[model samples]
Target: MSEVLVAFLTGLTTGGLSCLAVQGGLLASSLAQQIEQDVAMQPRPKGAPKIGLRSGLRPRPQIAGPILLFLGAKLVAYTLLGLLLGLLGSMITLTAPLRAALLILIGIFMVGNALRMFNIHPIFRYFSIAPPTFLRRYIRRTANREATWFSPLFLGALTVLIPCGVTQAMMAVAIGTGDALQGAAILFAFTLGASPVFFLVAYLTTQIGARLEAVFMRLVAAVVLILGLVSVDSGLALVGMPSASGMLRQSGSAGQVVDVPVTPQSGTLILNATNSGYSPTLLHAPAGEQLTLNVVTLDTYSCARAFVIPSLAVEQLLPSTGQVAIIIPAQEPGTVMRFTCSMGMYTGQIVFDL
Candidate 1:
């Protein structure tokens, strides 16, 4: 699947994952309980709610504290999830059925989450419980439910479960990796990339959450929609994209074939890209064996070239940047291998040395 598509899907999963981590179905219930407690503890106001000073500017600021807490907690959850996925991606092998199941679960979550952009959750509506049972039901110690750091942290965690479309796509990608550690790394990076907005929003939930909530929902939807498309790309790939992969493998730049004389063994190849922004990338290695690519880019200003091999029918994306040694399976011999930019523009190949 395309990296862009995968990024979108990963973003969605991160959203839902965040949601689940933070709330776990307790969002609405907890907020309602908090409302009850607040009302119960305070003396009733004598007159109608005055329009001026008490109401203040926008109500988002009031909720900021809770929002941050909610978002932060969720981010923590996803971070942990990422770590777990990375670790797992490195370990166990997955069966086809398991991969497919994970894909479907992820897809449903992403699509559902994207649809939520249009969804009007009762949680967003103003509903409060009576004060009588407040003490027994409230969860947080915040005096008011209007805004708080915890709210965002909770939402951030629970957001991951929202069933966003892109998350589904990402899940498929993670599953395809065949190794638990790699899958986890893919998810971890994806979630990390997508969490900043929620973190910021959590900090500002008080003065802006009401207005921004809708925007956030829309953004989440957009992310999921993109991810859903990527999921379709990958899911379809498992069935067969031999034709497309073939097309990608068909051509390379017209540079003379010198067969660069670095004799790395049949199972391994170390590529030291001589120029800035370019690395000798490969594709198609046997899926089960350990494979290594040693990359070094000359320029510090421009990040070095990263690599990817799309046709293994596996779930992880090969790195396109950063100087690090990651362990991945060698592509199956004869599998179409095509190298591309970190941005997914096809560059060249290693055509598996079967």
Candidate 2:
């Protein structure tokens, strides 16, 4: 799979997981209990409701199976899309406004989700559909239709229609990628990611209501949320869509960067911003060859000029102030040589032929 596809798929999958953690766990707990009681005459637990981690985690098996299924399916889906398509036929030019917009949007999403963790808005309350009392009360509780899993599948397909803030942010990401088919695939993966827990809950009735479920729930939420906000690195990876690490090494081209000796490369690059920005900003190198970059920034913030190269999928902040040193050795060819500063004010590109 292309690196771009991998990152997008990972992001979409995790985003869905996060959505489920938020909703499948506590978000729907109250409703789940209500639904449980509406059918069964089982009196509410005497003193404290037994809520913990693992037990609560059991509710979304339908989601997990499908999520795992979706991951594989998404790969195949993208393959199908890829087979009918040519190599990506678009420009990879990162601009400042776009980066700032994405960051601000994400930050806003984080802050908004952060706020929602505290309390839901009145407008949101309008759409917060818990099972109605009578729906809960008289729905043939014990004999509830397990065969209707087609329901979540039905709902999951259109899950985007539900107004969730984080999902909106993801929608923006899909749109930004600028591929309709890929976006739909991303959404499908996301739905599967979120549905796992809910379906699991429906499948294993007692497990969800088991004791010690609270701790597991908290852990799941924390882990998934942390994963969802892949930080600026993810943002960079999304924009760069780097095919291989060879793109980071020095090249033999003019007006480009070249590094040697493969010594310790600087961590964060700071470049002074300027107008009429630089091009071929991202530089890559093949294995065992020293690489370097010759950068000149224009028309943007110092941070924007800063070149970032994400390795192992971790975001690496580059210098935004002035020209700096970069080294990448090539071990493979016929892959993306390098992607310059993405998620910044300006961007440059370089393709190593060796």
Provide the lowest-lDDT 10-residue window in model 2: 243-252
Clash number for each model: 91, 68
Residues 220-286, candidate 1: write the lDDT tens digits. Answer: 5576555544444333333333323323434442243424323336555555443232334343344
The runs of at least 3 residues in candidate 2 whose Cα sits more than 4 Å from the true structure, single-residue gaps closed, are 1-13, 21-38, 41-155, 162-211, 232-354
Model 2, C-alpha of 49: deviation from truth (Å): 8.6
Model 1, runs deviating above 4 Å: 1-61, 79-90, 95-101, 119-193, 200-220, 241-354
Report how far off residue 76 is in candidate 1 (Å). Answer: 3.8
Candidate 1 vs. true structure, TM-score: 0.43
Task: Give residue 218's lDDT in candidate 2 (0 to 100).
Answer: 45
What are the Cα lDDT values of the candidates?
0.43, 0.39
